[model samples]
Target: MAFFGIFALIPLVGVVYFSMVKWNGMGTPQWVGFDNWSASLTDKTTLNAIKLSLIVMVVTWGVQTPISLLLGVFMAGRQRYRAVLSVLYFLPLLFSSAAIGIIFKSMVDPNFGLFSHIPVRWLQQSYLSPTLALPTVMFVITWAFVPFHSLLYQAGVRQIPQTMYEAAMIDGASPWKQFWSITIPQLKYTIVTSSTLQLVGALTYFDLFYVMTQGGPGDATRILPLHMYITGFKSFDYGRSAVISVILAVVGLTLSLTLNKLSGTGKMESQQEGI
Candidate 1:
């Protein structure tokens, strides 16, 4: 309660308040209720940003969920080599998002990035061009975030009782059948939690894309958070930016609550044989 109030609720109220008035992030905020909302909603660039954010959300969720799930299951194996693989998988999590963005930007640059010196004609292409910017960004986002989600799944997989697998084996179940019937059913709640985090986190992805593309190849990569930053800091349109912030907050909260409710995360039932 205390942390939510301090960090989320309070800032939300402040953003709502500021959205009603015109301000360049300084001086007294002039009253202009609903005007900021209207302008921001109608702006083509802002609309494009919203579309891009949704695309990113869907693509990341689709791409990350399966890879994370599979990797998590693989990492949960007791084999020694699996332990080594787990360490390698987690290395990306050690780097800051900004650092990942910068590193990737350099690597993917058509002019001076990794491919430039490789002399591979087919591989040498502009990754940040408008035709490819969003896809490349999506790939990087998946690469950077999959490890964390996979770790969540790994923990979930381990928490499943060993007896469950033993029982499945006794029933002559194959590995694939055990995974679908046993592992998938057991990890339902973890799926909900990981999915909620992934979806909400998508809306707030700013630092990575900011550092990587700055909303270019002609704003092709401008998600909502990046748009809000440019509107507030660069364009000095704090009022409109606050409106965007409120929209993002509302959408994020809605997604989280909706996912939790639909997943029945609050209604726990035992998955084990005799729990």
Candidate 2:
């Protein structure tokens, strides 16, 4: 808690303070009150970035979460070659985001790359197309992060007692019914935790976009973090960048709390503590 306060809490307070000022990050900051926040709220580029981030968040939660849950369930079930499959599933998580992005970029390169012979221009032009850019980036993000979420779900699944499954089987419960009634209810806490992590990650995603697309072609994939980076370093508008940071922090916190409440994790934790 002391370390968290010193490192995380202090920096967060600094960010909030800086957001209310006009600073270029070098000289003394000028107090501009709510000007920076007002400007950030109305900025078209920032708004677009927020929209793209939200799209990534929704797509990740919708597509990646279910897939991870299913993979976790499958891996947790009795199966041959489970160890090898687990290693394969976890291999992607070992790679750095930059490395993954660069490898995928090269693989999808239009010419002289792995998919060069494929006649389709999905990578060449369509990846940068307005309609496809966000989805393409979302796919890459999902591919990179799904392994971690799957591991979380796998742990959750392993915690379930095998006797429950045996009883369900004896009670004539089909696999699908058991899954829906038993597996999902038991995994609620894991689902909430995984979704919160993914949501926060998606909102502040930067490295993948930086290495792969650099928020182009024409800002199609410019998430809020990328926008903040550009405003702070490239444009030297630190105050506005700080504003974006504060916004992201608030949004992430609110959504995470809401998810916990809706998933009943908070109540479950309290009940467990009481017991």
Candidate 3:
């Protein structure tokens, strides 16, 4: 596992190092210290991308986490129909992101699409304007990710001992109180893990947004990945792209670490007592 982890981290390390240098992908590289990072921070386009990425992350977190948790707990607690329901919820995870994107595009199409029949041209109307496109894309991404996160949540909830619930009931705790004192505390690790996974996924998301909006009616849906694509491939500015990629990676890693610390799951034995 350590060997595989090292191999996986190699590319990430390369991108971070490359961000501190000037290179066009084919030429000899030159060290530029923090110039690329500084430029990425100050550039308007980069700033917009950062804003869009944050919007997507925030919306996805808000929408996906709660919905998935409810569905997961509901499904996990139902023994008779659990298998059937789990399959239904997890189906989205089995499909390609591109397929999901294509489906949403048609669903939100400006004219003749399913959404167009509802009076509002959801994808085209200024009411659902381009500036708000990032959240729209986040909605679709959230839908696609919910099932996978639900499965994680279900697994976590299942690990919680029945004895704890029994104890809560013996103490005359209400269902809400039991949930607060027992279910939630026990599920802390799962919640944190799911949130971290979603954060990292949202931060690097590309396929669903790319196919659904191509990052815009203008530059509205542009995110870090799309911004990196524009810089490295479209604009052919490899150095700047590497810098953005590095920022993205650091941001993702940082969020994961922060959430891990909050949940105490990184120290499982210590966490057991608190839960």
Candidate 4:
């Protein structure tokens, strides 16, 4: 507890300290009052970056969760080589973001990549134009994270007592009916947990976008973390970077609390605890 307390406190202290100063990562930080926060709010680039980040989060929620849940359900009942298949699906998540990004970039190459064989000019066609870049990034992230989400839902599905399925079966419940009545309710916690995890990841994602688009095609794919990185490292605007960091932290915390409140897990856990 003591170690965790100290470690957690360090970030809070740094946020407060840097948020009030103008530091160029050199000699010393100079107190700049609330200039950082004020400037960050008004800076067009930062504002645009925040917008892009929100877009990625929304797209991930829409595209990734449903597919993962479906795959989880499909894999849960099958007796065939489930472990091997799960591992194969999860391979993408095991690679470092840099490595994955480089591979994807190469694979999407127009001149000498498999994507070009589609009879369409995918890579050079600006399929990831300003309006499409963030969505494309969201697709890539979904592909990367979906397997882990499937594992999560699979675990939840596996935990539902076989007796429940037997009972459902004896009652003449069809597979779809059993799924809607039993599987979903039992896996509620897993759904909530995985959605929350994806939300947090999308809210702060940087690597895939940074490597693939570099938030390119004109700031279309720029997310908050990447914006903060560019501000501090690329532009030496530490104060503004610190402000963005604080905002990112606040957004993450707020969404986490919101997700927890909606999870229904708290009520269930409390009831179980009371018994």
Clash count, one per candidate: 0, 0, 0, 0
lDDT of candidate 3 over 29-109, digit per residue (tens): 766666776887899989999998898878888899999888878778867687787878777877788898888777766
TM values, all candidates? 0.87, 0.84, 0.81, 0.83
Q: Pick the candidate with the highest TM-score.
A: 1
| Pairs with steric clashes in candidate 2 | none
Candidate 1 vs. true structure, TM-score? 0.87
Please give the CA lDDT of all the candidate structures: 0.85, 0.79, 0.76, 0.76
Candidate that beats the other on TM-score, 1 or 4, i.e. the better one: 1
Off by over 4 Å in 1: 1-28, 267-275
Regions of model 3 farther than 4 Å from truth:
1-35, 119-129, 267-275
lDDT of 4: 0.76
Q: How far does residue 42 in candidate 1 sit from its true spot (Å)?
A: 1.3
> What shift in Å separates residue 232 of candidate 4 from its native position after superposition?
1.2
lDDT of 4 by residue, 165-237 (tens): 9999999999999989998989889888877887777766777878888878777777788888888889887
For model 1, how does the per-residue alpha-carbon lDDT over 131-244 read when each residue is reduced to its tens digit? 788999899988888998899999999999999999999999999999999999999988988888888889878778888889997888988998999988899888888878
In model 4, the runs with Cα more than 4 Å from the true position are 1-28, 120-124, 264-275
Residue 227 in candidate 3 has what lDDT? 88
